[model samples]
Target: MIDISQLNYSSADFWQQLTHLLAWEGVSDAAVTETVRNILADVKKRGDAAVVEYSCRFDRLNVSTMAELEIPLNRAQAALNNIPVVQRQALEQAAERVRRYHEHQKQDSWQYTEADGTVLGQQVTPLDRAGLYVPGGKAAYPSSVLMNALPAKVAGVKELIMVVPTPDGEVNELVLAAAAIAGVDRIFAVGGAQAVAALAYGTETIPQVDKIVGPGNIFVATAKGMVFGTVGIDMIAGPSEILVICDGKTDPDWIAMDLFSQAEHDEDAQSILVSPDADFLRRVSESIEKLLPTMERQEIITTSLNSRGALIQVADLDEAIEVANFIAAEHLELSVDDPAEMAKKIRHAGAIFMGRYTPEALGDYCAGPNHVLPTSRTARFSSPLGVYDFQKRSSLIQVSAEGAQPLGKIASVLARGESLTAHARSAEYRLKS
Candidate 1:
């Protein structure tokens, strides 16, 4: 079968082996970086002209102007109406669920008054506009539209612009339908580094957005990284990752298929299974061998499993959690007897699929949680794409006459200690005589 790596947690070099397996060079190479840098500069300088040129050159379109590149609202609505009834219903239901779920995450402005009558608080407000990038053409990800757009709408963003590349003039109706249902303000059939540049720096037609969310290829990722300071980004996501902590209770076939789910995403995607039962680990291996050949993306799954996948034999479930924390995978599944209890100890993971019944695929589509999660080890520090990502907070501070003296003295002292005469004087002026 499949030549997936097997390791033991008790081995002295287990940590080193895990580190090597988890390592993925996400940074763009110099050539790709330079190409993205040039694209950003060109698009920023020439506006729609550069975007149009790149779109035609890269996407194999012959469109002459940016106006031809935009998908009209009527067309988007038509897509929603023309699609299969079941698909439309599914999109609507998913959109509603995503909207409802993110509604709870919406931050509200709040203030509190001190005893001295000073006011301090946070003012929360949505962004003016946000740009979303969808890998288009043959990439039929209506879920991406729902996941990225609904949160911004829930946060009350005034406008949302969507960019999806239609390579070879092929368009995905479901993506358009999702855009219509999610209330995307604008749709542009342009993608890649040029689309990112057009979003970062406003063009003749595409308005620059306050932030950009969604996923793309290496070129798009590099462009996002380069233009980060100019606008906000969700995260520079890595390959898909899934780590399953099984206590040998779940079906071996189910576990094998679950690992295959993420591995099928790409050849670089990673899948790992940790368990205390050596016999169960062997059973899962057998399941992978028997089940992989039946998969549609068998070649991709094979390559991914051969290159990055692992079936680790841990000392026990406790050690499994320890290894899970060290990995900080993008998606984690607790397929054990006490999933809830094991989940309570999980300190790092982009999303935790608790219980054997809860599959990670649900979260990817209609689980009422945004599937746009922090990949790689970023789960340790970052979070999933949520309404909060589309909103900003401003600290509120007000000082009464009685409160000014004490605050002013504190500020003056800090400013003077830093050797800033103007800053110290500005605060000192508010001090009582």
Candidate 2:
């Protein structure tokens, strides 16, 4: 039997208990931060030489130059063609769906003319290049490739470069195949902080990118955090999280498995279920005990459930939503009678899976939404990765001679108030004598 924590909303210390459970220290330790800082500095200074050295040291590769690290685009296409017909078709379909969905998010440049003939608007433009880091070797996450790369492509990025670590020379064909389907322009076999540094600072072979996106280990995450100012990054994601708000109507077995889905990601991943029915929570706990032994990752699920998982008894569905808003989980499943209505009240969540039929796994795969989402309460402020992430906006302001006088006068007043004579004079020069 799993030893997951049980919380009751009526308890005076329920909030304190929940807050303690929700806490996760995601920041890198001093040693890790220092290691990342050194790697970044080395890569920035020595260029391709440093990246090659780290790749060899960390990835157990026998390469001597950065050129050997580069994976030809044709190889990705070949992987697409060589893989099982079913896998290839699935990747293509997923890519197409992701592309189609992001197409709607594309922002266009627009301008409006004022009565005084001044034009003001915004111009939307895609980044020149973007870097995607996929965990390589035994881990095959074609969905991540589709999720991160397709959005940049839909935003019309000029070039998309992907880097995956081929530890001991092992490569994942599925990731390459997905990249081909997503139209990734370049591929490199490198990983860790060195790969991030190469993408951020530019090397002899790897051109610097405007932004980097995708998941990696502690070293990679730390490197991304350090290089944030030099290049844009998706959120510094925490562990996988799923919060299910059930009205005691869904099958106990289904709810148990849903919780297990995220728990199986790793031991640190969190899975919680909130409901008004006490008996239903007991049944789900029983299901977890009964079904866990059959899973391949049972040990991982067990540790995760034992450590971070919970079954909370709330007063009602409204209270569940209130708790969810406070938690701001990365993935929220509304397994209630009126999921749509409940979703209407959800103020914060990375992704909302509505109804018992819509599971979080669907959104993770071919559900036509980017699975890259904010974690660790970041959903309170950030959003899921979309075409908007790869696109930038520039404000357009063109003042006509007649309009310049009024605008300049206003600017001059503000600049003078700030005690900047040069700024005031610069604006005043545009005003009428």
Candidate 3:
């Protein structure tokens, strides 16, 4: 059951309570960091041998050689035919929607010229290779495959590599099918920190990628953090989180179920509801109790909700919105009337679901938006994974004689101001003609 109070709570107290009900803090434990550091060091020193060793230790699978780790294209294709028609159709539809949405985000090279013949522009180019890590231990995430790989394909990345851990040496058929449809160039059976290391440092079988974008466990995240300079990474994702803003318009069952969606993901996952209605809070709390016993992952959800979930009774809708903004949740739902109106006021959130009908699950699977979003309040500064993750931009500038004179003078002045005589001289040289 949830604690409900209508009393005007202090901002400090509210934030403190909210922070306690979040999974962000626990993902970066000292032990986890130390373990990841050792794994990365071993990989850096031993390369393929260390990757194979860690794969055996962590995944409990024996991958003897780099050759044994690479998934055959024929096997991946065969898995597509093995899946049910309806499931394959659904995946195809999701992939199509994801591809179409990201297609719109694709950027091109552009240039603008001044009267003096100075040309300034930006040139956008897709990365040569991208690595996508799909988690396979707790559950199979075919949706993650579609979300990560489809966007890279849309961005025109030349090569797409996917990695998943399978203790039995058998990857999920649905995962392979989704990868096939999404145009993945390669698939590998390696996972954990080793998979990340193979992608970052390129084992004999796995090619080094320009960018690595996907989700995994803490070890995978730490490995990405360690290899950041060697290769680009999307973000060090934390556990999933959801924040619901309701105003008694929707059923309590719906609200409770929505909260459980994230909670069931992991014991450390967070779920919170901020509402002005005390009765609604009570109803949702009761609904959660009723719903808990029926779910297969009831224990996980109960622990998550008890430890990291909250039912905050705010004085008003404005207060609720304020709290939501401060939290910067990964998934935000406005389950009130005129959700669109409230959406306008929201400045930070990875994804926003409007009205009572749009559950977070819809966005997770078929809503066209990538589900790989920033967690741990990073919605304040970061964004969901998309086509942009697979692309890079470089500025382009060209100057004619007339354009050079004026720009050179300004550059020289600025360079001299910074006490860089060599920079000033370079600008002066451009202006000499």
Q: Estimate each model's TM-score.
A: 0.99, 0.98, 0.95
What does candidate 2 score in Cα RMSD to the true structure? 0.9
**Per-residue accuracy of model 2 over 1-433 as CA lDDT, tens digit each:** 5899999999999999999999999999999999999999999999999999999999999999888999999999999999999988888887888889999999999999999999999999999999999999987699999999999999999999999999999999999899899999999999999999999999989999999999999999999999999999997989999999998989999999999999999999999999999999999999999999989999999999999999999988889989999999999999998888989999999999999999999899898988999999999999999999999999999999999999889988999999999999988888889
Clashing pairs for predicted structure model 3, backbone only? none
Candidate 3 local Cα displacement, residue 231, angstroms? 0.7
Q: After superposition, how far is residue 173 of candidate 3 from its true place, in Å?
A: 1.4
Q: Candidate 1: lDDT of 117?
A: 98
lDDT of 2: 0.94
Decide which is better by lDDT, 2 or 3.
2
Check candidate 1 and list the clashing pairs: none
lDDT of 3 by residue, 206-251 (tens): 8889889888887888889889999999998888999999998799
Q: Is candidate 1 or candidate 3 better by TM-score?
A: 1
For each candidate, what is the lDDT?
Answer: 0.94, 0.94, 0.86
